[model samples]
Target: MDRTIAVEKELTPVIQYLSEKGYKVESIEFGSDYSKNIDKYDAVVVTGMNKDFLGMQDVVSKIPVIEARGMTAEQVYWQLNTSLKQ
Candidate 1:
């Protein structure tokens, strides 16, 4: 199955890179209600600096979250790819 990833809005470069690699990518805002929507994705790529914006820990515990802070688009892509391999 194609890997579906939810990427935070601030990581536009990462989104573009993932899209180019053929992964289904969705843009999500930092403070949005992700409880109902998060399950649709296999993983989430967020900025480490904005990790708290997703709200309570319970809401994000459902899936693996990859922090993209201080990383390039290629690095983020590799990070997400590695996470999926485990």
Candidate 2:
């Protein structure tokens, strides 16, 4: 299956960078829009700006999730690549 990363508004840079690296990523800003289908992605990357998602920790926990706090686009780029190997 192809890989994807669930993201939000503030993390568009992360998504764009990941896309350049060949990852299929989509961003959903509304917390209410998050669904089980998000789990189909290789991972779910949450931006620090999205405090709304904090309440959905239960669902987010069901996948290979990455929550970045004030992390730069470069950091997320390297982080995702690094984590995918483990």
Candidate 3:
């Protein structure tokens, strides 16, 4: 499945690199204008949540969130891999 990831900045080097390799990455600033429905995406990737969107009740459990903070690429990769299986 293709995953839609949200990054704070556009073409962020960190996210860009991941996208170049094969990740479906998108840039979105929560509570601001966005190109698409943040929840419509299969999976959500947050690269350090902003105060406005981080603690918002709407996002807390609406979907599966893959927080970029407090997580390593290895851990994320494994989680994604395992999720795909189930």
Candidate 4:
């Protein structure tokens, strides 16, 4: 099965990179609704600049999340890749 990842809409570069790399990527807007649907993805990535946009950390406590703040797409990709390996 293909591993699916959920990326915040603000991280367009990361989203594009992951999509190009053959992972199933889903664009998600941060809000109350996001928490409700978090289960649909294998993991989540968000720009750490704005935590308020993502509702609350408690909502995603069980999900693996990568904070891609101030990082290049390549760096984000490698971080994601490493996370998946574990």
lDDT of 2 by residue, 35-69 (tens): 64565667777766555573465554446567777
Task: Give the per-residue lDDT digits (tens) of candidate 3, residues 1-86.
Answer: 37665555532664665576576766666664442366665555566545455445444445556566776665665565555456
User: Alpha carbon lDDT of residue 76, candidate 4?
Assistant: 85
- Candidate RMSDs in order: 1.8, 2.6, 3.8, 1.8
Pairs with backbone N, CA or C atoms under 3 Å apart (clashes), candidate 3: none
| RMSD score of candidate 4 (Å) | 1.8
Model 1 misses residue 4 by how many Å? 0.9
Candidate ordering by lDDT (highest first)? 1, 4, 2, 3
Q: With candidate 4 superimposed using the best TM-score fit, by how many Å does residue 43's alpha carbon deviate from the native? A: 1.1
* Candidate 1 vs candidate 4, TM-score winner: 1
TM-score of each: 0.85, 0.72, 0.57, 0.84
| Clashes per candidate (backbone, < 3 Å) | 0, 0, 0, 0
In terms of TM-score, how similar is model 3 to the real structure? Answer: 0.57
Instruction: Give the residue spans of candidate 2 off by over 4 A.
Output: 50-57, 60-62
Better of 1 and 3 by lDDT: 1
Q: Give candidate 1's error at residue 66 in angstroms.
A: 0.8
Look at candidate 4 and tell me the lDDT of residue 60. 41
Give me the runs in candidate 3 sitting further than 4 Å from their true place: 10-14, 32-36, 51-55, 60-62
lDDT of 1 by residue, 1-86 (tens): 49899998889999999999989999988565876667778899988886475666556455678888889999988888888888
